[model samples]
Target: MKSGGNLEAVLNAGEFAITGELGPPRGTSIEAVREKAAHLKGMVDAVNITDNQTAVVRMASWATSLIVIEEGLEPNYQMVCRDRNRLAMQADILGASALGIRNILCLSGDHQQFGDHPRSKGVFDIDSIQLVNMVKNMRDEGKFLGGDDIDGPPKLFIGAAANPFGEPFEWRVHRLAKKLAAGADFVQTQCIYNMKKFRQWIDEANDMGLTEKIHILAGVTPFKSIGMARYMKNNVPGMDVPEDMIKRLKGAGKGKVATEGIKIACEQIEEFKEMKGVAGVHLMAIEWEHRVPQIVEQAKMLPRPVITPGSGEA
Candidate 1:
């Protein structure tokens, strides 16, 4: 076990795990965190706290994750390379560990052009791939990025993002391999609306035995309406929503789109559970945190598996 967090322990115990996300408020109130955490309290192994998702400047992920810990929930703190340089990234890793965070998702964040602060400059001192390897070294080798010794290093369950839907499809699986070689313990992909392509990508990964070495959580988001479906298909980058999916939502009409969306999500969850290489599902229900419990229960994922620490584990 890299960290004593329940997420690693659960996956290590060979059980299918569920993790949800929490997008913190734009301001400083912790009540939003409390309310959202309450909804996902017992339903998920961990709740991912996004760091300024889309670079819109929300509350810091590390600070919000502390509140999640207070709610008795494990946190998957996301850190993006666009906002912080190497020094800040290293400092945040140490700070997060001291505050009891174990899971960290390293990301090459979206450009500021899509964010509220379009005039701000980005600080991509290093890419996501390098960030993953750096975290691995900090945790396993007890050394800083500059090769300086540390009295004690942070224990982290490192993770990286993979966009199986992106272009040059031939290169996606190889990209996953690169991250694995860099020491990413797990990967969560972008929102999945086209399972055929996702399955193919995972198939290639399986052929390479990547699944045996790391946990791959298929990303899923419940579409709220036809407009949302169209937005993702036409506007969202790296999204591959098939025309049939859009037709399914459009066919639902205005009165029942959310209901239809939930059905589609449940169906995908069922399929993901049966996928050969998928170890879990990562639900990125943006601004829809309250719907998580109902979705999980309706999908028959209640009564989460029991995971206890094994030999030589704290």
Candidate 2:
């Protein structure tokens, strides 16, 4: 298994780190995920396997991450505290480590009512911060909640999500600080559509010294149409696609709106590409994975110095 610290090493070796999210299928068939994995192979540093994303029933993240690993790609295994208690959460972390899934994204999942299954009860036995602490303990102390030593403690490159655009922005920053203090090695932010606000947040993070503490990957998603833009703005918590973007979508209309969105996303990426404290962009294309390579290429962020596996040492 690759060392869990490799992710931090890679991020530190360069000014930018690129990662993409892959939503696992809800069914038993592995064919769909396998196809997606094949397309993403060698194109990104890591592919995040979403865990019951949006509270919808889907393929468990651990299984999907294992599939990505078997496909010869780095898998960012997402672990959400909404569905599992401390026991299950710790067990799954160990299980993921055994499967060679080194990178983990800790999250407090979306409420069940927001998902397709409204009647399903939510199990937020552990919040996001506590989950981070759990993983930190498992990594540092090599013991579970009961203080019993396992065969071996899991080594995980822990990633936590942040929403700079969410409500009570002060609370957002405070929580991010808490997560980092709890041992999050890196942070992947929510979709950022407003460059001005994004810059402001980056400034704040830099002032708080997070810029030096952990790799911060700014999230960007391409809007397919005006409908999508509206839906995301209205529905997705911690996301806000501005009116100008929606106007752009309306002006571009059906055929080329996605291309327009791509341009916008690329522009956002380019704007942050050379910034001193910004680490890199985390592209979340949802089902539009095929467009990522083009976005990267068009942004002229390509031809980055390749740090082949073992070259990330300090």
Specify the highest-lDDT model's number: 1
TM-score, cand. 1: 0.98
Leading candidate by TM-score: 1
What is the C-alpha lDDT profile of model 1 across 1-314, one tens digit per residue?
A: 79888889888877788899999999999998899999999999888999999989999999999999999999999999999999999999999998899999999999988999998989999999999999999999998999998678998899899999898999999999999999999999999989999999999999999999999999999999888998999999999999999899888887999999999999999999999999999998888988999999988888777575674253
Cα lDDT, all candidates: 0.92, 0.82
lDDT of 2 by residue, 1-314 (tens): 22444455568676477888899998987888888888777667788999999889899999998888878778899988778888899889899898788899999988888788988878889899888888888888887877888788898888899999988876777777889999888899999987778787788888898778878898988887778889888977778788888898778766998889898888888888877567888889889877777877887766544566666756
Q: After superposition, how far is residue 217 of candidate 2 from its true place, in Å?
A: 0.2
Candidate 2 — which pairs collide?
A: none
Listed per model in order, the count of residue pairs whose N, CA or C atoms clash below 3 Å is 0, 0
Tell how far residue 203 is off in model 2, in angstroms: 0.6
